[model samples]
Target: MDTMRDRLAPVLTRLLDGDPRVAVLLAEIGADGFTEAGRRHPDRVINVGIREQLLVGAAAGLALTGLRPVVHTFASFLVERPFEQVKLDLGHQGVGAVLVSAAASYDWPAGGYTHMAPGDVALLGTLDGWTVHVPGHPDEAETLLRHAVAAGDDKVYVRLSLLSNGDALPVDGARFRTVREGRAGVVVAVGPTLDDVLTATQGLDVTVLYATTVRPFDAAAVRRAAGAGRADVVLVEPYLAGTSTAAVNDALTGVPHRVLGLGVGRRELRRYGTAAEHTAAHGLDPRSLRERIGGFLGAAARH
Candidate 1:
């Protein structure tokens, strides 16, 4: 199976070649993997060498000089460590950049708590006008990355995860697409969690919605898909728990509704294991999701 890295390499090459003003900054994470690109575009592709803060600051500086900077690193390093630089240097300065993060959430659980960053998306939520994309598959990642780069002067975050869905949905911008219809309620699957969501809701009767873009939240689409009044909303995000709860709540303001947010657990597991094992531990596996969903749907029906 092709990973997001596989798709991103060629797209980066194309992006660097097409746009003279486009540049790439790395914090020593994927320097070796991007050898070919670096060799081709010596001036544009720069390795900042293990300094996350400086990586973002430099990118912001480049953006100020009319260069479109695409910063790359792990989620923890990209958003968590140098967040101040992202907030002050990039956001405060009003310079736009496309931040691409790998090893999403627990994709590298073996890397332990230091590498895991379920809170990355939530932290970015604190900032203003930042577009976030959590692609389910490599195709979706490619589409989102290319689109983000093409969108001039827009601050964007593209999250890349190891887990992939079976099918590729068309890459529409920041809108929730209806996957299935049912009277029970709505199951909104975000990013890589689509496969688990589909499996969890397989036999159940509920409307399913899919979205790669979570920052915008697509409230109108949620309202439309949820039918007329308040409907059961189960948000299955790939990031921290309850990241999109506020947006969903604001969308259906007048209607009284309840939400069950599911994602990586807030508490640190602090154990070394495979990603699958970590997923089960956090009750995010297909079986666990099914049980939680069944209970939520059942309770909703009772009320």
Candidate 2:
């Protein structure tokens, strides 16, 4: 159980240690910390200036020359600015590289709208042959990153949250954890909101599902958890209530499924706040989730 920092540093070291041709691209700001790590394996690290579009485009070009490239940048710039490059140069051209997105979702409080790109999932989902992964903790992050490196996918986007000090939840990229399996109701959570989901289920006969992968969801696992009889399923997220929840609900057609999509609303968000604040303001806090789950269960019981 290595700390996330420990896990990530060594994984980067190994990637650098193994391939001299492989380049590690970092944002100007991220360079400070990553550069120190790169000192242990200096030749592999390259700073791509503040140009995220060029960074991704360059990575795609380098991949064409038989060199594996790992690009790192804020999620916002990576997804928005170089969207054309991502879809055309990387995805359409069938380039093999990993786009390591830092500060995913509400993790970047200091980074306002320009810096915050919570919709990376929605953006990447549209690209063909692009593998999208959002790791809940550092351990899983390391594993998934390594897999992306070796994997032969044309394009891969990994949305990484800040390092969590808490214990890592049991995740295997396929079977999500069902913390509690009760006949009463079902609560499904996606990435890092497990705490809120758990809190929302107190004193209720609820089955909780931790959905780690928003794309390529496990339909069988979801259907089993949703239960065929009379259980109610609620999908929870920390982003806009669209793709992930909608996809799951669509998959479980004819089943009783409800989505509680929680994220930054369409309205212009003004204040800069931490992930906790954003979740709370968006009705994703534990108390709010608890109330909603209780009401849903109560209604289900009556029917």
**Root-mean-square deviation of candidate 1:** 1.7
Q: Which residue pairs show collisions in model 1?
A: none
Local accuracy of candidate 2 as per-residue lDDT tens digits, 1-303: 453434554676677787666678775846765766577656567777888788888888888887788887778878877899888888778877888777666676776878777677777877776666666677777877786677654467766776342556656654677777777767777776677778777767777877665657667767887777644667776555555666667668887556555544655467876777777776778898888777767744222
Best by lDDT: 1
Which window of ten consecutive residues has the lowest lDDT sum in model 2? 1-10
Off by over 4 Å in 1: 299-303
Clashes (candidate 2): 0
Worst 10 residues of 1 by lDDT: 294-303
Q: For residue 78, what is the lDDT in candidate 1?
A: 97
Candidate 1 residue-wise lDDT, 1-303, digit = tens: 989967776788888988898899998887876789888899889999999999999999999999999999999999999999999999999999999999999888777788988999999999999999999999999999998998897899999999899888997767888898887888899998999988888878888999999887799888997777767899998878888988888887888688899887788886668988888887888999999888988844322
